[model samples]
Target: MALFKRLAERQRPVLEFTLDGEPASGLLGDTLLTAVLTSGAHLRGSDFSAEPRAGFCLMGACQDCWVRLGDGRRVRACATALEAGQHVLREPGRRP
Candidate 1:
């Protein structure tokens, strides 16, 4: 069972991107966290136990959803928009 659903049948534009060198896609208006989670990708791993971590606060207050770009720049996934052709890397056990 899904926790949420769209009120109406509406399709948004799809955007393509790469996650850890693999191809992935998501809706254009989605945040990076939504994109990755929708695609069944793990956002990152916890620093203490190296457990897979996803969004916590969803509002950027908690740093659990932080992800890194291919160039090693980090961004809060929940607050960042998904861009076409964007490349995101998942580094396990990385601190925010």
Candidate 2:
């Protein structure tokens, strides 16, 4: 039953981005932070475990999803859906 339940779960969406200047791909829909952490990408992004950051509120109530856009702007990853060709920077403060 457990195995069947796992297979019954819908597959996560896919996201394409770069990690440490290297190309990478990952599932979307889930929180960006969770996706990044599971992707095994080498990044210097926000320390979600430290520095007053927390993902307990997955509903975007908290600003913990804040991420640096490739254009040098900050946006919440939870509130923003992943785009096919969108450029993304992992950390909260950084410019691509």
Candidate 3:
């Protein structure tokens, strides 16, 4: 189950990745925020509210779309590019 459905630009090359240990794919040149939301079930749950967050600003300004990389580094999904074979965890500080 995906969050946001892709309505346009469906012709780009697909890039494969993992979301919380689950295999997922997204279009090339997509942002991590868009990739995960459209390919996975949902974004990371909020720490403050324990509810799902899609992202507030949709840019790099807000601190809402943070995700953990395989190396344990934190990055904003909204500003980060979707990389091929990326291991993304919804929980911050979680290593792949």
Which order, best to worst by TM-score? 3, 1, 2
How would you encode candidate 1's per-residue C-alpha lDDT over 1-96 as one tens digit per residue? 222233543388889999889888778788888778867646788877778777788998988888898878999999999999999887688555
lDDT by residue for model 3 (13-65), tens: 99999999989899999999999999866678787765777778988897989
Give lDDT for model 1.
0.80
Q: Order of candidates by lDDT, top first?
A: 3, 1, 2
Off by over 4 Å in 2: 1-13, 28-31, 41-54, 92-96
TM-score of 2: 0.55
Model 1: runs farther than 4 Å from truth? Answer: 1-10, 94-96
lDDT of 2 at 4: 11
Question: Candidates 2 and 3: which is better by lDDT?
Answer: 3
Model-by-model lDDT, in order? 0.80, 0.52, 0.87
Candidate 2's residue-wise lDDT over 2-95, tens digit each? 1011133257667777644556555556445544444443223346433323244557786656666677777676666656545666663333
